[model samples]
Target: MRTGMTLLIKFILTFVSAFIAFDLLLNNDISWILLLSLVAMLINYLIGDLMVLPAKGNMIASIGDGLLAAITAYIFDLLIPAFTTSWSTLLWFAILIGIAEYFFHLYLKKDEKVAP
Candidate 1:
């Protein structure tokens, strides 16, 4: 649960989840999805994890992450012609990312505790 490790896991999870989520939900170019995932992950980690998690709790932080993911995806889809998406698709991506984020937030918390 060191900072480095946590960030690594966060990046990996974000990348994988976003990649797969978009792949499953949208008709889009792989390159566009990858780019979008990186952007979303950066924002999610910065705002959702760094900002929200410390101020709020895991649930709120996870929700925030989901919201951020949904917004990011929507914006990207609008901007990128090849990235197609819908409301239901966005919600599905959010839900999936949020569940994964919850566990990542838990991992952060575990890192802070005193080991027995």
Candidate 2:
């Protein structure tokens, strides 16, 4: 149950960040942007949030998500011209998403740490 809720939050955060980046920065079509966001969200949640985060901690997990976002965005840009953006823009997007993911990570692991 907790995992499910965390998943939902992760998905929502990824979707919003990706959607804004693709739609505003790249000038992509709404439908395709939505689809891309969904795919990215799922990938990040499964790999970054669920798998790597618990084992490695927030910084590494966020970096993992950023890398995942960059690679995913680059691949999608290759497949769809409208989704294309400059490398700098993609880097910025990844950074912003990574910061957000850090906070989400804290939320997900709030009870996992013992107080000193």
Candidate 3:
């Protein structure tokens, strides 16, 4: 693939993944997901080499993302008197993230195999 295309996909996927993860963060509203995603993306981008493989990078990202997502969800629930959450919200968030991850991986791998 062309370098430009790869970078573009990376930019788009990063935004999509972050947005979905942020939404999954709550039944109500909280903004911490924004900060958390920014932090995680920055840290990972800076240390991308340390991750070595896609799986390793994903593992690290997932931990940071998942924890931050949970915190954001909880905080949103805490602040909004009218908002309610289910214990299952966490599970749904996890599932949604997992799906997002799988698709992102597929897209990346496909891009790598295709001609520029």
Best by TM-score: 1
lDDT of 2 by residue, 29-76 (tens): 777767776787788887987789878989999998988987888888
Please list the residue runs of candidate 3 whose C-alpha ends up more than 4 Å from where it truly belongs after superposition.
1-30, 39-86, 113-116
Q: How far is candidate 1 from the true structure (C-alpha RMSD, Å)?
A: 3.4
Worst 10 residues of 3 by lDDT: 44-53
Clashes of each: 0, 0, 0
Q: What lDDT score is found at residue 92 in candidate 3?
A: 56
- Which of 1 and 3 is ahead in TM-score? 1
lDDT against the true structure, per candidate, is: 0.81, 0.78, 0.48
Please give the lDDT score for candidate 1.
0.81
For candidate 1, report its TM-score: 0.86
lDDT of 3: 0.48
lDDT winner between candidates 2 and 3: 2
The true-versus-predicted C-alpha distance at residue 4 of model 1, in Å, is 4.1
What are the per-residue Cα lDDT tens digits for candidate 3 across 1-116? Answer: 47556445544544445555445544334344444445433443334312422546555555544444445555555875654456676555545544444454455556655332
Error of 1 at 33 (Å): 1.4
Cα error, residue 17 of model 2, in Å, equals 1.2
